[model samples]
Target: MTTATTDLAASRFALARQVADAVLFEGYVLYPYRASAAKNRMRWQFGVLVPPAWGPDHGEPSCQRTELVMEPRGGAEVAVELRFLHACRRTVEEARADGTFADVAALHLPDRVLVPWDEGTEERVEMSIPVAELEAGEVCLPFTRPAREETEPVPGTDGRTVGRLVRRTERVDGVVRLRADPLDLPYRALKLTAVVENTGDWTPPPEGAGREAALARSLVAAHLLLGLSAGSFLSMTDPPEWARAVVGSCTNRHTWPVLAGEDGRADVVLSSPIILEDHPRIAPESAGAMYDATEIDEILALRTAALTEEEKREARGTDARAAAVVDLADTMPPEIMERLHGAVRALREITEPGAQPVQGRDGPGLPGEEALFRPDTPWWDPEHTDPAAPHGDRVLVGGTPVGPGSRVVLRPGLRRTDAQDLFLQGRTALVEAVLRDVDGGVHLAVTVDGDPGADIRRAQGRFLYFQPDELAPLEEA
Candidate 1:
């Protein structure tokens, strides 16, 4: 019964849930916040749970089962909590003068179609059929729609069709049941979610409290699905009133207490954020947000290349406090200013153009110095094989054809490890050699144009090795 450990576990679960929530809305930073955008169409792209009915080629299934498993360490008392979106559906009917019914293809629900539970003027309720009921094959649920009619015609549809909202039901086509009673630790993990069918039909809900109903309505209309369940140990004391209230208010989040025994170990597993048509699969542990590492690296590199000189300067300034101190030092203290001047003078003297030291070689008395330094075979010599010359085989470099002496721009991306010289990105270089390594992989050796010194005697040489994608060929000079 370690309270501190249980509390820590609860906090971690809460934070993880928050991270998942952020992932859910990652694509909202677009011009139109709807899912029609090519970018936004990838719904539930992460945390996907695939059911058995759907294959890779067949695509996602409409209905599936999802489950979570929790194992408490020792004999600890544990509570489990869950949250997710519920699916609701409503039928739209067109009024006919002949008292005949015709299907309306263009009618869309602007808001959630409410259902009334009793006839005594009670508030309308949602179609919230329990999983147990669904598993029992009880498909029909009571649902009612408001007596509202579309004032304006739905865009892109025939104007002749006037539609009226009639009745609605909880969509059970996608997900049917979330089975947990059969599980060993049924109390710790269990949830039911249904697949949403019309993802493009509903609008996203606004953020903040008092919008659960709206959110639920939107999710059902969109065919978005989620489920949650919670269980607590009978021995453990009840949670605080405030905590219980918060849990009740937040439909998408839940909290539960865990009782730890002598061994003090409690493990809780939950379904992934998205459940596909297949059975729900547990998601792997993630480092905060889910994103492609390679994509991130490429983006970082591009952003760095796109930085303006002024922006680079600002970035190099470290922080405001340090920048302020340096700015103040410019006018204060004559001694400090004198030291700075001395430092600049010394730097200038050392970095002067001709200040490079020369190295002397021993025994350079070859019979013909020019002939010894020059290529033994001419460029036109058919029998000659010059390593410096481009190979007959064509190779792509950064999506462009490249050969020896081809001017190329390095695109080392944001990872310093990806580049031999971190400063080479966006800088022009020459293709000195294209060679095959021991593994038979093609490598491009390019010498950076503005590099201070030639890499003649260095082991790796002045030619930095790069993959074809890392260097873009420049246009003919």
Candidate 2:
């Protein structure tokens, strides 16, 4: 590739890396960010490619498959970059009187406390092939990280070695097999499949070897960054009608591929272990990586800052990245912190046909701007009609004023908003917010009480909406 062309590709990958990095460290550490925290005990949870033997028995997978469709022009080339984390075991040892070091769970120094932890090192495998070559023959990228150990001395105030940190990484072996075949379509589209398998020879110690034992042999946060040197990739999540069936024909196992990089340009695809929409980008409000995708940045930052000083210190000693997250949260600029609080991206117009108008101080919105409220809210009130100012709105549910925080049993009307509402038939939920529709309809945004994922749903702002009339309030105990 020419230098300029190579530079352009490098720039594209750089933009793509921001998102992939987020995925890489997700769940690497959780809230509180302390080693002693229960949540941090079980690590390497995301996209873990374990030994094939331990996978079936332990409910983990040994491989992740990513399949995507692309339109390749003549002489178009595709380059695949496999990125993942190789688990490393870090042990904190204290210096003995006789010049030797002994492994200790925690080495307490004047400033910080060091603890034993398993960390991940970034690894990648890259290869490129012409689309024709990929279609004709399969390509393999066999990757290996050799076992190695390193030690860094932790010096005291006087510069003497009070303790040392020893990090050992096991030999991790994996392979990525790439192949492509033409889809029988009117257009020139190719279906590409990339399978990543853990070919590590490490044997499972025993049935009770625990997850860590297998994690050492696994590929953590394994994902792919696929680039089309020429043509563009199609969106599997929202494909055009012509290629809808073709997307269905593409089989993806334990992986979700979505168009990435610049918006509207499908030259890059991020094959993630978790679900994501097309052209997904990081929220601009995020201050930094908190290593938890399910929770809001503001909440995590606030929670991290709220950690006790002792707790924070312990968290800082867990990993350098974890320490940075804590420090960012603790010392984040006021403006940045405020931005994380929230923002209204855009208003969807609920002023469609049969929709009602919402009153505003300036006598309802302009006909020009009124059409922006239809997508999300059934009612169009950006602070006037629907959600903007409905939080305080109360409706009588079983003769009780039901507003935010009111408990109610859902009785979704026969005209169901969603088929899944059937499962929530009589479940009790807490009203999170009250919203009004342009049609004068009221929606009670609620979360099911006792639901295992209730907190996560709340954190994700994913609550089920129901009309107030469909709810029967329960008195607070």
Candidate 3:
């Protein structure tokens, strides 16, 4: 990907592909690697949308969603069988926990063999849940599995090779259905959770690898969401920073904000604390919304596309401005121009030029321009076309070109009198000193012929350093 590509989008896409691959395997939680020939493979579908802030250079944004399908192995499976058998001998509790299982069993047997398993089948069961008794927060959904691994027998082991014996049994499948919201209150927000099955047939992640992967995925999704926000929100100031701060403040109940710029382009900013507390937009006055990993990824992808487009549009303006500055500098008077050129050349020797300003030459002498003109050099016929001379972001003087990389100083108020008009004609001089700007732009410390250490300085006290665009060919338009 190009440097312009957002890091979040890249991560989201990567994880989405992994999840898609994982769900396609059979026996999702129990034996992911083992496929029951009769079971159907998992499939995913996703889409993307662009946010309002990101411009055309990025791309269109959209969302993508994937649906998971689980199929059982053949043999008319009517029940979910969770079998735990001890293949090795161990202490009472250690033997009871099977280490044969992958992630589920690994927890108990940090070093030894241990296993735990959960089986979910499409079976029906009766429950005595009262219709009216179910309050809003009364009933909670909880799913728990073994925290450690359980031990199992090796293929041909008469006894066992790894750990001790463990107890195992079958777990009946439970299906939950809601008759109605007992409180009869509408849900204030949306909630989403992911269900991942660890099939033991395949190799499990190393110890806590699974948890690490999950966390990593969440971070990636969050980033994508931010990217989506950038596409939708357009701000005059630090758009990226504002977008980040806004998203960081989002909660479970808040909706994303839409940002529009003066350019008529729009991007989305994630709801922030400022937006939630200070603004009247988005219902509930809180960010209390939850999204699944996939949902987050898709939203972020869309935002990324929008931001990319916005950036491309922005870069175009920058390039144009650089070109314009070069043009304007070319139109200055000869006397003023020489000083500007000389002073800048001196500056370049000390610091890197900010932007390249092209240089141009009028005739050797325009009418009434004798004070700044020289019959000997003939401004138009000036012989200084050596590539060795500092070309872009550099200056040419006395037949030698000076680069911005060297240190130089300007004599205050055109102190030097090579041609006193060079400074008198509203032109600045180059002297030895350090220049700094806080808001933006480049800074430099130059070396001049006179002052050993010049501290206090201003724009008028020095010559403006030029970049590549600040100078042009001696005569070429």
What tens-digit string does per-residue lDDT give for candidate 3 at 110-136? 212222222211211112222232222
Q: What is the lDDT of residue 130 in candidate 1?
A: 38
Report the Cα lDDT for residue 304, model 1.
40
Instruction: Supply candidate 2's per-residue lDDT for 333.
Output: 90
| lDDT measured at residue 291 in model 3 versus the true structure, 0 to 100 | 16
Q: Is candidate 1 or candidate 2 better by lDDT?
A: 2
Which ranges of candidate 2 are over 4 A from the true structure?
1-6, 206-208, 348-370, 373-477
Off by over 4 Å in 1: 1-12, 24-31, 35-42, 56-74, 77-477
TM-score of 1: 0.25
The prediction achieving the highest lDDT against the true structure is: 2
State the lDDT of candidate 1 residue by residue for 1-477, as single tens digits: 111223534553453444334434332222121112344333233322222222232353222233222222233332223233332223345557785545553333222211111000112122333334433442432222232222222222344544543333222122222222322232432222222121222233344222222222322212121222223222112223323332233222112222222111223233233322122211222212212222332233334435454433332222222223223423345543333332111011111133342122222222221101112343346765543543544455434567677888887733224334577768998787676432223567777786666466234555677766566777886
For each candidate, the alpha-carbon lDDT, in order, equals 0.34, 0.80, 0.24
